[model samples]
Target: MSTLLATGFSAVAADSSSPQELIAKGEYLAIAADCGACHTSPKGGAAMSGGYGIQSPLGTIFASNITPSKVAGIGNYTEQDFARAVRQGINKQGQYLYPAMPYTSYSRITDSDIQALYAYFMHGVAAVDVKAPQTHLPFPFNIRSSMALWNTLFSNNKPFIAEESVSPQVNRGNYLVNALAHCDTCHTPRNALMGQDDSKALSGGSLGSWYAPNITPDKTSGIGSWSGEDLARYLKTGHLAGKAQAAGPMAEAVEHSLQHLSSADIEAMVAYLKQIPAVNTGGSQSRDSYGAASSTEQQMRGDQASAEPGWAVFSGSCANCHQANGEGTSYYPSLFHNSATGADNPTNLVSAILNGVHRNVNGQQVDMPVFGPDANFSMQLTDRQIADVSNYVLTTFGNPKVSVTAAQVQQIREGGPKPLLAQLTTPAVMIGIAAVVLLAAILLGVWVSNRRKKNVARK
Candidate 1:
């Protein structure tokens, strides 16, 4: 593997002191990659054993086993095979991996870093003999062969080329964010084909039920007001005082990935992020700008009106932990000035209510109970009931205009928005439209040519 790496990137050999150094570097790369966060079992299982069920449009797509186990993992993969998988989205068996693996972003990784990552996974990390359950996406998505077409349309696995105009730190930051961290995979919105719309890079995206908000430095819709330290602290702790708190996928990213990253690397990411073009996604207020507590009179006077089902539900169920004024305790997050409740969209808030949230930060466990129908230990809310409570929270504690219907709650509980692929027209219909457009253009060109000829004859 080392010899092969030397052939591709001689710098890898030059930088590496010994096997220990290669392994150490690989570990660092893996931390940046955040592999364990996805590959590890969702049930608090071992790292890299691969049991997480990633919710997608079609269905749940389980992450593959990347551990160095001979049977259940990539233990038998050669260095070239590993490189192809990481950078090219090709498996040892010549299968096209789904874009969920984020090979498009990994494609930008330098060969040297790839070599170190291969070394770490192959030799440094312990081999785990666990086969994650195979993904069984419905119908068209189940066909792995179709992924080849998807890859052709969208995938780009190219090594990072440094721009001479940028500073060394900025270049390094770019590499980390675009390559190692694969931030664009979540932050960048996807087109109809589920390919990233880079035109609006870091301008927020939807991950099924969860929404990954814009991280581009926009003053209202992004992290523009946040200082470098604010970014770093949020990454390290998954909480930033009154500003924001990580939930859903962000929480997992912080708990498993960012917390382990070096302070310098975190700062570098911040530096680069701060410089990206700011794009406002319509909303004009900050995430923490809404849901301020009312006057002391309002706080003291409780509304226990049974006629208002939402208020009644809130008082009956939520007030114990969140308090009557929605001023959460040390264990629970406050509804006032909370990002989830105050965001322009209430997807996260609704999802949290339905699915709940759990995170372990440096052994300090933070968990919120699920109120969905299938929630564990008997804390389930009917569609109407959930809608009512959600509306109550949004209006009283978050935004007055924000509201949810029982129908919407039902849809979110089932699955938020339709997958891009599912939402798009059939391939046959698209092809017909293209053909008609081509025919029209050809006819117009011929007409123009004939008109020019007639004018010449007249002259």
Candidate 2:
């Protein structure tokens, strides 16, 4: 019995390795998990010392400092404790963590990867004593127990299972894209309960001031037109085909995570994304109209339009850009057809119009002229006007169920929009510009020749 115990101890000792190798592996896994994107403060703070605020349907939750600070961070956590927090969404005290941590997806990550991540974060990562801000949840939602109910209905504990029929690479890609990356959490539309509508995976959704575009392989509504090369380029450089670039949450994903991943891993992600079944959530199709808003208009007109101050304000300020028809310009984007306005939650719409969208078109970062006081543009609209306009858009053209207040819009405006505009020209716009320039040059040359001939005759 003593010999057996000695043998077990020897095996455990053999498994333990040098700290440097463990830390290096941990760094790679951390990148794969995109931990820094949320845990690290955006304004150049120490790594893993969280201060970034994540907006959700429930409330605005600030990320906790994962740095090895005993009092302020996860320094006291052991390997098993870290694993539980990451995989099982539990804190060291055994309290359930918010889904905002994306542990529902991370639950499928290999144990080996989780150990490596734990090692790197606890040892290699420098400790910082930054205190995390409390999440500002309204009323009864402030109760952590409510999350348990939310989890019971939506949470799945099962790990990703590889399909026997699919290729090994494809399966690996599927696992990474669906489970580990949790891409669907943002891209897929949600139900009234704010749970992901699995039936409509990768169809597109709005988060804060940004819209996660359709990624499924649908020719008209999704990314069927984008080649594998386009996906790779977008992931690598955050630019694609001069039409779209990664921005908002996606930009963070690219810069902090996807860009650092192996080319093979990226390819696997692309492969998995391509195979995702196309689902049409009937979001905005064109820039003119948000799509169909007859049902929403009918519902809103019957219910509290007169009592809602936002309705009157929206009619006055938003009607010009969005139009009374709610069909906006391609350059402007029609609110009626825009998914951002029509989302199950109105947080993004409130943030976007108040802050305005800054897009990169043809290497030019075109700022969506903001009417808010904070922006250097027109400041005709007050906070109330901004709130009313947002409310009106969501009810009349967007989802009527989701109501936004003036105060919420004010808070989001203070946070600002995600900065990830790419500098590149669209092919169609570039050709048109070139053609006009060539014609102008030819006409100028002809005028010069004619003027010279006339001058000689006069002499």
lDDT (0-100) at residue 280 of candidate 2? 55
Give me candidate 2's TM-score against the actual structure. Answer: 0.63
lDDT of 2: 0.67
lDDT of each: 0.80, 0.67
Candidate with best lDDT: 1
Write one digit per residue (lDDT tens) for candidate 2, span 337-394: 4546545545556655665555342344534546677665444577778877777676
Per-residue lDDT of 193-254 in model 1, one digit per residue for the tens?
88999999999998877899899998889878788998889888888766677888888888
lDDT of 1 at 53: 84
**Residue pairs in steric clash, candidate 2?**
289-337, 290-336, 290-337, 290-338, 291-337, 310-388, 328-334, 362-424, 362-425, 363-424
Best by TM-score: 1
> Could you tell me the lDDT of residue 58 within candidate 2?
52
What are the models' TM-scores? 0.86, 0.63
Candidate 1 Cα misplacement greater than 4 A, ranges: 1-14, 295-303, 376-378, 423-459
Cα deviation at 410, candidate 2, in Å, is: 9.4
Worst 10 residues of 1 by lDDT: 3-12
